[model samples]
Target: MVLKLRSDFFHSVLLDEEKCKGCTHCIRRCPVEAIRVKGGKAKIDEELCIDCGECIRTCPNHAKYAQTDSMDDTLQRFKYSIALPAPAFYPQFQPNISVGKLLDGLLKLGFHEVFEVARGAEILAEEIKKYLSLKNIPKPVISSACPAVVRLIEEKFPSLTGTLLPLDTPLGIAARIARMRAMEKGYRSEDIGVFFVTPCPAKVTEVRQSSDDVGRIDGAISISQVYSRIMNMLDELEEQKSLQFSSWKGIGWARSGGEQESLNEGEYVAVDGIHDVMSVFEKIEMGELSGILYCEAQACVGGCIGGVLAVQNPFLSKVNVQQLVKRYPEYHLLDDREGKELVREGVFRRRRPFQARDVLKLDTDYRKALEKYQVIEHILENLPGLDCGACGSPTCRALAEDVVREKAQEIDCPFLLREKMLELSREIFDLASKVPQTMNEERGKQTIESNQDSGTATGESGS
Candidate 1:
């Protein structure tokens, strides 16, 4: 697919120039170089930006923010838009709200249908089980649900591409199933738009990317934007009715360890944060960590509720989600035979043979890398190992990589250049000291021998 930014995908996170201090914190923190300082203010390069929201987390000025869709826009998609609430959505509305009451509030907003992405999560859970049963899968199969993480693999860690589970994310799968159910009910596809009440920009990007042919999920609306509308409606519907739907176990897939815990066994590893996930994935690929049946990876540190665009704090959301899950029926209680069958047929399969870059090319393609390697070796031979980013790169190795990448010259790195200068200065001083004293002593001996020869010649002439 020719990738382009979807206009409907709301970038709730934004760079506020007036507020930005241009610290370049966002620039360094961005897994992609999405944020760059231009004209003394940080700006997002929309083409390059995957909307990971790392900048949103790093900015002390709170300059980066997400753009919110007005309730008016959500309503415009249809005569009545259905709210596809993610399981993470439940925790945002507190003491006054129950998941059932929240569904009623969505109906109050004129949503003709309300489906939980968690129901899709149950289907996904079944699909994941079947995938695990397959032969010769990548070690610690990485979850591709998080768009920010996928984008990181695409850009920074292409080697991990094979490891990403290509299955359509639960939201996408659920949106498709939701739309199909709507069609079966004699609703036109256009008339029944599925809007995701999202907690993060990553989901927005996923909706825009639209990896599967399911062709559901029209747009993603940030939870922060719709919270007030949903909150007000909850107050209005005093005796709100809950929709008869799938078990809460399915909806319980909202948090970090949810997927791994749902599976409950196997050599599973659940990790959050893009950096940490990559580190673990590397070990898995290198065979340092093995025999992993599943890998639950979430981009936001604490998972979706910890998302940069989330209105509620993540720690509190975890507590709320746990309480909500306790009220949920156990997974074994659900009768999702069709979902399990579909998974066995490989209907919801993830694509494979994903890209791994040629890092070896950096050495083979240019002689300069070898030269830089030598310079790095020499620098290490002399300088202290304390890696300070005062040289502009994050570490000494990064400085060396920068030199090879032509991103920075060797002299730009102060520590390496300082060591070279010091070594050169010492050699020059030692050579200067050794040369003069030996030459002066030899000249003095020659002068004495000449005087002795002149005195002998004069005495012989007088005799």
Candidate 2:
């Protein structure tokens, strides 16, 4: 079983307690149930977190943030660093900026060279086309681009493991190509670094991992983190049109339906947004979604443009990406020859395919875990079942599970606490009504003697 230790999880996404108001927005918004409210604070379970960046997007307090490499720090790591900007980064301006402008911006930032990850997307798309054309590719072969979506399948929807297409992501392909290009220029491999201008925490986590081919990329910079720096240099535009490689076909990859376009087939569905992807995957698991050759599941809504770290409004950014696509020619800079040669050499392939994370394995002993699950179910039956979120859980059943596992107390539920308080009040009132045993006996005797004395006095007066 592939299991992730909590200690080994990347801390790209972190919560600022001082800024967090414990509003429960983040906990409830989390797709994987990785977050919980505790002690008036939001706590993230590292073992369960997929680094989706949804919490960062949803948090009104701006408490959630991602740690990314800065310009100074990133440049210092290599004698020559290459910038690989995502296609989504292209649409920051209204007129829809040229790819040349973006590449030039990276050059000004001290990168010896700039590569459009979009170009990589085009090559990967070509490879995917060849794979799909072979028709040997599995029905509903899912895209391997978005790390968050891939991790989601690994963690939550393990049943759909067969649906994942065994292809390296464009980012991974681009990194290898960039290194190869640098080596051709007589630079040592160790001296050249590839820094991705990323848009989400998933990419950051991907870059940090040594195992992921895409992760092997030297480092990453979040778009929002470096937006100001790039913006400052935007007005001083130096267009290196010759250096530009990706076309509008590559730019089509910036949004949700672009991959479907790349496939050149209408018999596919592209689902964007984490929740939508989850719902669609559930249908796929149930064998409800049929007749689709490919499934493109992107974690961010409106595709990569809707990533959490984006400074531009997602809707506007999305428009910008679309405009860039329509204005430029489709296959102007797609390098089929070199891309295929690299693919043939297994340059863009992984040693082993991704496996499901053993998130459901609560214990090594099956019998013990089964017994514990039974107890949790029984505890769940007694819960209020309102899923109020007041108990720091998304659902009453979740709280029951937590209580059974001893991770939380029953009193954490407001309804349960009120019942307990009422029961304690009744016990206190009953105790107050009764005296101590000896004191009660003495009081009883005095009452009887007083009654007898009163009767005798009445009799004597009558006589």
Candidate 3:
């Protein structure tokens, strides 16, 4: 496939060049190989990067960070701002606090209204279960909730593209519902902006997808940034509503198995963490996991709770999810009628298929690419073969590929430069040895004798 770079996409994950030490930490840790150190600083390839925040987690210098909308500034643009907090947002507060209190906290923090993304998760469950029952799709239908996972599939596992579920994610559904409710309140669509309180930069990238006319939310605020601010405000808030707005199944979305729990039928396989998702995706691609009906892959280890930007311990946050589910183990009336009407009205429209990225392709031309591949292979043969990050590439072969692309040179490899220096030193010694030993030993004495003879001849001429 000839993959095109998504120049239109906005990446919240940015590099502060002044702070980067160029330690090769991000390049080594990035799952998609999307990061490269160029000119003594780390740079992200927007097309290849999934915004998983791996670089943010790995950078010791704090050079890699996420840029999100300032909530204070975001509120000024709209008369009514709805805060759509992700399920991951729940665990950041004190565990004893009620879900209603959390929503109240949002209201206290300046939002006119607040909506649980979990409510959207519950609504999405019905649609996915329906799709699985009727469609003759490939097995192991992957979840699209995590934008990082969806982008990863598009870039690294194109063969499994058909396996991706067609449904929009919980946040997408929540945004739609939030806006609908706002419009019902007499707020103009343009006047009300929906903001997502997100745990990762991936959500920021997803909101930026609005440029393609597919975006649901207006902006995203970093969860870490929102957490401390909200926690400070929680003490002054009072619960103005009740937890009856959402169901226990929706709350389950904070963890790995939560999505499958919302479904009534079909065998389920749920995995979290980017590395684990990659392993499971590879199996699905090989048709090894065909018996499974659904595969929910969360980019973070404990689902959204494990986001790199999160301040809370992921395990502790997961405990909070379980506690919330145990305490609120009740479902709101199906509102089956509303869900059906939504389905009829295309409220939960499918997402556009992600275009596969040709990250592995070296060149656009067939013959030229073939020639470059061969050259890359030849360069690889001369490398040390250790996948060391010293030269800034992840592997020897990667460096060779970069060299072939003229992005780097063999001299960039310290080991290769050392070898060249040793060879030159040997050559110099070998050339010096060509001087006869007698001539070499008498060279200093001969020089002194010539000088003395010149002086004696000058004295005789003067006499």
Candidate 4:
């Protein structure tokens, strides 16, 4: 199959040309071969990247960045816009800044209305609880909330796709409800735009990659972008009007264990960060993490508040979210009528599994794969396992894979190829070191003359 580049599939961690030193650390570490060194800089191949935030954490130069939508885009789409702020956003502001002050800041930024994504979290918790009550599916349901984790299953672990929790993400569900309420107030659906205040790049990728069943969310604004705008408003804050906010259960989604707590299920384990999530998923795949009802995996460590794209200190956000949650009741009931309708309409739908790419040459032709595999094995056997990445490939295994694809050669290995060249040079020097000897008639003539002269002298002496 032709490897078509899907730019929409992923977003870049903004790579600053000035900061990059051409180190391939990110390129080498990426599970998918998404990073490419081009023109002395690391460039992300959007089609291959999953926006797992690995590159952001790994880049020593801090050059990687994610794109955010301008507020103008949201304002231009509709006469009125609703700011569907993620719970992670709360921590970016001061601890004393009430939710009402936060809402007022959103209004100052031109949002006609403001809604907490936490409320949407409450709805999701209820739905998950109902799902648990019914014993239809397999044990250890993987959380569908994390787009990166979901994509990982789609690409590397397709067999586990069925186990992914089939539900709309908190942001999507929240956006849906916000739009529904806006429409109930006699606002035109087309005129009302809902923008998600996102904490990570993965959420942006999710909105683009997932099917358009969750239609209410028009766009995403990164926390970093909104932080400055909100900060400016905070500077001018004096007397803030009071507004009723959603329950803490809705806002708890910014944290790692928020989802499980929202559902109040004792059988679930909440995990954060990509590496830890991968480890847990591995256990699930191995049938070791069974008997558990749900596995809430967040790719960003410490959950959404700790997302690479977020502006606040993750720890501070965690504390702020906890304080915010403490202010409201632990559990709040969602008017389930709209949520049930959304489920029946198939609007709030789960992403389906896409077919994996035939990366193996064997899938194309076994005979060709066999030939290539032999060549690859020979090259690997001679290679250094150091994975130094001097050959422009990530590791020895990657070089082997590239060799199979005819993209690289065995001589690309510096040490082994250098040694072979040294050996050949020594052999050539030995062959040239041999001296040629000649035996000639002139040598015999000289020896005969000397013997005659010596004999004549001896005869004269005797006389």
lDDT of 1 by residue, 78-118 (tens): 86477788888887767346667778777777778888888
Provide the clash count, candidate 3: 0
Which sections of candidate 3 miss by over 4 Å? Answer: 1-7, 211-215, 436-463
Name the best candidate (by lDDT): 3
Candidates in order, TM-scores: namely 0.75, 0.90, 0.90, 0.84
RMSD of each: 7.6, 5.4, 6.5, 8.0
Report lDDT (Cα) of residue 168, candidate 4.
79
Record all residue pairs in model 4 with backbone atoms less than 3 Å apart, i.e. clashing.
Answer: 13-64, 13-65, 14-64, 14-65, 118-250, 118-251
**Candidate 4 on 1-463: residue-level lDDT in tens?**
5445463445735677888877888888776666766557887765557788888878998878776688877788898799888888887776678777787788888898877787777777777887777777876888888877877767666667878777777777777667777888998888888888888888877655544433546788888888888787787653344434567777788889988878753788889987788788888889987889988989888998888878888888899888888876645444468556877766456544444444334436788778777877887888988888766677887788777776667677778789889999999998776433234355455545665877553322221
Higher-lDDT candidate among 2 and 3? 3
Clashes by residue pair, model 2: none
| Residues 1-463 of candidate 3: C-alpha lDDT, one tens digit per residue | 4444464466888999999998898888888887777778887887678899888988999998888999889988888888988888887666788888888878777888888888888888888888889768888888989999998998899887778888788888888777877788888888888899888888888887743332357888888878888778767867755633776788889888999988987799999999889998888888899999999999989998888767788898999888888887777755778878777756677655666666777888979999999998888887888777788887888788888778789878889999999999999999886654346656545555665877553322221
Colliding pairs, model 1: 11-67, 12-65, 12-66, 12-67, 13-65, 13-66, 14-65, 166-350, 167-350
Candidate 2 vs candidate 4: which has greater lDDT? 2
lDDT of 4 at 319: 91
Candidate 4, lDDT over the whole model = 0.75
Candidate 1 Cα errors over 4 Å, as ranges: 1-14, 32-38, 43-50, 211-214, 238-248, 330-337, 340-347, 350-463
| Cα lDDT listed for each candidate | 0.69, 0.80, 0.82, 0.75
